[model samples]
Target: MTSSSRRVVVAINPAASFGLGSEVGPALVTTLRGLGHEVTSLTEPDFAQLLDATRAALREKPDALVVGGGDGMVNLGVTALEGTRIPLGIVPSGTGNDMARGLSIPIGDTEAAITALTAALHRPPRVIDAGRIAFDGGRARFACILAAGFDALVNERANRMRWPRGRSRYTIALLIELARLRPIEYRLTLDGVEHVERALLVAVANNLSFGGGMKVAPDASLDDGLFDVVLVRPLGRLAFLRIYPRVFAGTHVTDSRVVVHRAREVRIEAAGVVAYADGERIAPLPVDIHMQEGSLRVLA
Candidate 1:
């Protein structure tokens, strides 16, 4: 599509980022319209409803679909647009905006992001990798990251907290969970290697960060066509306390107790483990994950 004919659709999650979606939606739409592009704003919808909206938007053949919520919303929108030529745009307004941060998209200023989106619309779309998770009956999806074990527990707690939002809430939740957290035994087949461990957390990442800003897989690249597997081995509370802070700076991988590896696919099985994909609980035990290389086109 030509730049002048470009149409932009913004999917807003009013409940995301402590309810900033309502406040940000109109402003973003106004800005984009002022730039001479057609714009549409959509309120938060369930996954199926959201998919329908995306598919309808695709029929219109918009130049870009600007995702205006957090990581989960972004994942939903991207899942609908995957394998198509539609270039995805993002305006980070969610609790963890980790995917936006990874792509260097602006977070705070709506006007600046509008400008960036407008410019990005004129450029060629870049293809990136997305992660997929499968279970017995069906499959779940993720665009940025996924985690199993303690980190998933932290996510559950953070979702329940009411006071703080974004990274602050995540930190508080982590501290709360750490006091009583226990490691779990799991058997995993990564790429072709098999091993078992009592793991505190096992993170499989397509992008580098998750849980607001924690660098779960520091060396992970979106276009690398591989998943970065991060295993946090069982450690004492004191040791975990000392190591947790380093994840923020992307230096936790240097620790001897932490194990990081690259693989095209991973198979995980646990007795009573819950798994999370992009912060949403999808399944429990016996999960399979694989990387989809250059499957998503983003306006980055």
Candidate 2:
């Protein structure tokens, strides 16, 4: 069947991008229906409600599930759609639609994204790897990158801020966290081999970028079946700040302070460090992350 005649369920986070969902959600429904596809548009009160609604929608067996939000919405969609055959569609309308950016989905332009997604859905869904995280009691899956140590701290702080809206909130939160940067004691076991170090940041990447297009792992590939584990060793405040700009251009991978490794399964443990992936907090450190090859099917 052609994509235009298929059934689609669009789940939107009303709070995404601080409120973009309120408009984007209705637009998606209208667009999808206008294309002659049957669309179910959902706007939930919160993340849990969104997840539950999307999960329920999946049981109806729609041709695809399109998310109209950011990376966090994609992460939630992945958690609900993983191991299933339905293709995931993205409309980037959030603070950091890095997953959309990494997947080459048009960012910030909802019409362009919808056009791209509609075209992509006409073909086979592109298979991509996803990171499965296992912690003390529970587990979760992330579609983009998993971050620990200093980056996670920044995410924690950014999520707590009320003033200074938009990206400036994150910048302020990053500065606040940067002022207190310190080496974290890390014990990492990658593919059964153990290594310990004092690192400032550790990122396990499936796609190439995160945090609104910061190319923390420039050489990462979503279908490679391996993770690009980028580690930044402890650096003084001035040097660390100097390397910050390089991350936006993804040049930090070549720096002397950065180390890159490839592994299928990794066990990470860092004292007092939390883990954040796709702009959502997963859990504290001591989580085992593994690359699940071809686990995600993206319409992009």
Q: Judged by lDDT, which candidate is best? A: 2
lDDT values, one for every candidate = 0.82, 0.88
Tell me the TM-score of each prediction against the true structure.
0.90, 0.95
Give the clashing pairs for model 2.
none
Worst 10 residues of 1 by lDDT: 14-23
- Model 2, position 99: C-alpha lDDT score: 90
lDDT of 1 by residue, 146-259 (tens): 788888887777877897956799889889988987888889899878988888999889989997889989899989999998999989899988998999988999988899
Off by over 4 Å in 1: 1-3, 16-19, 44-48, 157-176
Q: CA shift at 182, candidate 1, in angstroms?
A: 2.0
Shift of residue 136 alpha carbon in model 1, Å:
2.7
TM-score of candidate 1 versus the correct structure, residues matched by position: 0.90
- Across 82-167, the per-residue lDDT of candidate 2 in tens digits comes to 77989899998887888988888888788888889888868899989898999988999998999997889887888889988778
